[model samples]
Target: MTDEHAPATPATPAVPATPAELVRRFADRLADLGLTEAQAATRAGMSIAYLRRVLDLGCDFDRPALLRLAAVLGLEYQELVSGRPEERLHAAAPDADSAPLVGPPLLGELTVPECWTRLGPGGLGRLARTGPDGPVVRPVGYLVHDRTILYRTNPDGALAPDANREAAFEVDRTDPKLHEGWSVLMTGALEYVTDLALLAELPQPPAHGRWVRLTPGTVTGRTIRTASAR
Candidate 1:
């Protein structure tokens, strides 16, 4: 009888597989093809003796034989061997322009340090808020690093009142005319840094950017870019 405490099987769901598992399963399936061992060996481009030797010794055929066997079995060679989309097998490595997108309006979430890191030296983020009054958006430069986010503002801007509170920031790069590009949104608690000396040391200035520290409580974000721009 089943043990009541036995872990239940998980619900059926799509899953990704690792490479070695693919190789082992393929070998077992090859063993059942409609052919004698000698015939299978010959078609797989191996000497019957060598095939029998490996079989007796319990080793699967090497990659070359597996590849030839796949061909004889009408399989897509690259997909079976590399475990990636056959289309990508011939394509260059993924990048901003060639990568498949996660999906449209790619909604996702990720944890970050108290401060968001530099998106790059040129990265900028926009702060948006919906208070008891309503919604507002403003572009701001950021000096992000481990454990803290830094930036300059009115020191009493719309976002200041929301400091040490929950809020969201968004950064996006998209081609509106052609309806492409990506957008990223981050949500978290916002904390304002009041130490003037610390703010004085932050790296912010396109000439006059100042520093303010924000200790993020939690960060959840997602990226949405073109599939072509992986």
Candidate 2:
């Protein structure tokens, strides 16, 4: 006999490898939705304590309960159980200007914190500087630590910026097929780091000697995406 208090069996979409995996994916999906556990449980017409027991303890949840949670998270019944999203990953951006266009683009800005989150550590970005000859831009590998940009170059090389000089650094990515892309620009005064203690903690490459830092005064970013994506 069916228990009248039990929820109806939700649509089974995909099965997860383990109960823990399913809970973790559900939590991630909830985070992506910007929902709290209580909020999600309330929306799914369940008690907070019971939801917590299931999610935190990795206890088995009935199919009906799973369906309600999936609906609340805006995920396919199976996707809620699977740790990975249904979307496929794409290249960061095209290599050259000659790359074919996918469609007309829509543009938007990313907040400073978001910009830093995207920049992360050890990625390629262009450093712009003003030289006696003229303005110049060159590609460099950069790391973001404590919200400061750090890079390495030969002290005598053109890649090295003079301390106290203003500079601009940029990084961007695009997905032509998805008609989506973003660009981040950081402007700051370059400071050659002299603190041995701090330098020792940073990434040390045997081939590179001089390590410099950019303390950004301005960080601005823009994103372009297809209308459908929003």
Candidate 3:
């Protein structure tokens, strides 16, 4: 039996780039066809969770899982097995750091409710808190209740707890061709829900153990809605 987490015969990392780079390299091609992990999984005749786990496990991905992922990702199986950068098969790598769908200087004020409607579990948000370490961003699941947004993030997510005590969470989806999409940002003060009982009151699965509250103020957002390249 082989472990998916460990390399078959490890020496070092594959890409000078980060795992994020690898994930990004494939995201666009996936999106071009309006494909997501869900769609890819279906095409590959596998489950979404299984595909997700394979990508998440990357270097440690097993033979069968790796094979399935490569097929679904429009990659050749031998390339995945080789783990060689030159052999890298994905072609959608970004020339620069920019979301795929954004083209021009599209900007405006959007509301928190408007943003929340589009933003969900997959997007990451940065937190500004009282701590001296400064802001940090991480992916988080989100929920809304009575116009208030709640996020469950790690304790270390806070930057300067008392001083800023707020978070700026943003999510956007782009389409370089469709020429349009939207960006949503929510700025508000956050309070730690340290109380075990009160924490339970937050709307989430029982598996989520803790989180914080964001009472939004001066909410803002922006939407491209549509754009034309020609």
Candidate 4:
């Protein structure tokens, strides 16, 4: 007979709603493992600064570093990405009745037009530049205007590039469960947009102090998909 008075099993926590929440979960897991951030970073083969930035500032999500860190923390990659404990157990032991294993991922290059299509209407992307300390990469919201990239920032902010300075921008999306994604990169010169006439025609009014444009010298992209999906 089932004991109605028996203690109930705890419900599994819901998946993190955002990247910042995922980082917080990582912190909790780190504490559970009784390891400091420095120790975890060392075991994960990454710099403490980079780990701190990811954990503390919610900076760019570096996949390779995260995969290594997940392994170091004794968790599966999918579990780390999805915050689902069941995924870890499932990865550890597959059911014999389950479907056959998926093949390796296939990568293919994207043409210039295809790259633009992938970047349609723009959204959030990483802007890379050389700063006083070293290479700097930060996320910024952008829009594609007349085949050029436009983003706004404070005139004195770190994202503010000098006239015609060289920089790189990248945007990507992925599905951890499906293991498929695409990334588009733009290498170009960044300059201030001073054309009042052109600025007046923007779909949305400038929200920041200054508008900057990335005039691409080259555009490239790549897509990754599981062989089974092909």
Candidate 5:
């Protein structure tokens, strides 16, 4: 009798980027199509928990999962497999209106609800606060929960225990070609969320265990676009 072994699996078309980046791109694209994570997961034939696990670094996913994700998101499988930057996710209709602005571009206010919608649930944003050295700003990974901004930081980090201090958190999206984008600014006092029960209940990046909440005193935003752009 001859010894037999299974044939080697084919290698991935390209080196896979960090799962978080791939997942974020997927999520953002789906969001542009007005779909939520749960909806997308269901359509992709995967549990939300499994999707979240894939988004968390160190988790494993096979090519079948990748195929399902690409098909559900309407992405090209080859582009995804090769991690092509030119095929980066963008607004579903990148050039919906190509007409010139009737007047001039102007900054317009975005209502609180609009701001929250644009902020979504995940991504990086800037957190600005007053420090001993005056004002400081740092990039932070954040999630929106119950109209409040939440992020995790080391217990000893400067931003971790700022319980009564007012701070500003901002997130934005832009299109260089269109010269248009929107920004949301949230000003609030920081509050520590040390309750284990409460922490477990909130939606956040899986790798972050320590968290702080920003209870917004004011949620304001602005957008730069022509009236006809929409």
Candidate 6:
């Protein structure tokens, strides 16, 4: 007689051996995350057509594209490419004096000029302003122009600040492996950009939206160095 109370065995995922199989595996991962092809492509900063083409045609392995896709899928690059889970060893504590003692992290304040230097051709930053509900912080792509912070936002969006309202913007960079980083903060009056001439002078046109400028009243920065080379 067959047993009626046997536990169901979990199905094993198939190992991918070909380009087409790998793409299918990627699709499976997206499904697991409740994401669609378009969503995954968007998060990977690639076009939907490109994603679909890969899925259909099974192109050769592209490292850059695969890396971005792996990040979006929340999988390690090796794990995604090899169709196997990443193997990581638990780090063991080092014995006392096993290695040269790199003294405690050195913290230092940055000068005004140094702060500007650190902000160099900005990438992304946090914009803080008061919204209809309360204080709000949003991530925004920004650039340092004429010693002021320039960013784009929807005119009616929650991130858009009132005319000449006080706001704060911050940018930072860190390397987890190196245990070193720097952060710069700016407090200023935020206002909508009405100067078309100034906008034209920018290296590139801002995204289709209202351009905002933050004229900082005070700027401050700090840096932490854990390695001797810094």
Best by lDDT: 4
Best by TM-score: 5
Write the residue-wise lDDT of candidate 1 on 1-230 in tens digits. Answer: 01121112232322223345454545544532322455556667788776544434332345565566555533545434443232232233223243444445533333342113213222467877776678878776664455455566664567664544565676655443222433445666666565677654443333533345555554544333333331
Model 2, 60-174: lDDT tens digits are: 5566777788777655565565532212111122232344555566677777777876674346789998887888888877766689888877877666767646999999876
Against the reference, the lDDT scores of all candidates come to 0.47, 0.66, 0.50, 0.68, 0.65, 0.66
| Model 1: residue 37 alpha-carbon error in angstroms | 73
Evaluate residue 113 in candidate 6 and report its C-alpha lDDT on the 0 to 100 scale: 82
For every model in order, what is the number of clashing pairs?
Answer: 6, 1, 13, 0, 0, 0
Q: lDDT tens string, model 6, 1-230?
A: 01111112233343433576667678777654445677678878889987766555433545678778877766656556555321111012113113342678778787788888766545678998886689999988776678998887887787676764689999887644435578889899888777889765443434557778899999998877564322
Q: Answer with 2 or 5, whichever has the higher TM-score.
A: 5
Candidate 1 global TM-score: 0.40
**Cα-lDDT of candidate 2:** 0.66
CA error at residue 35 for candidate 3, angstroms: 22
Taking the tens digit of each residue's C-alpha lDDT, what string does model 3 give over 52-115?
6655656555557667666654455544444333223222232312424334555455555555
Question: Candidate 6: worst 10 consecutive residues by lDDT?
Answer: 85-94
Off by over 4 Å in 1: 1-118, 163-165, 175-182, 203-210, 225-230
- What does the lDDT come to for candidate 1? 0.47
Q: How accurate is candidate 6 locally (lDDT)?
A: 0.66
Superior by TM-score: candidate 1 or candidate 5: 5
TM-scores for candidates 1 onward, in order: 0.40, 0.55, 0.42, 0.53, 0.57, 0.52
TM-score of 6: 0.52
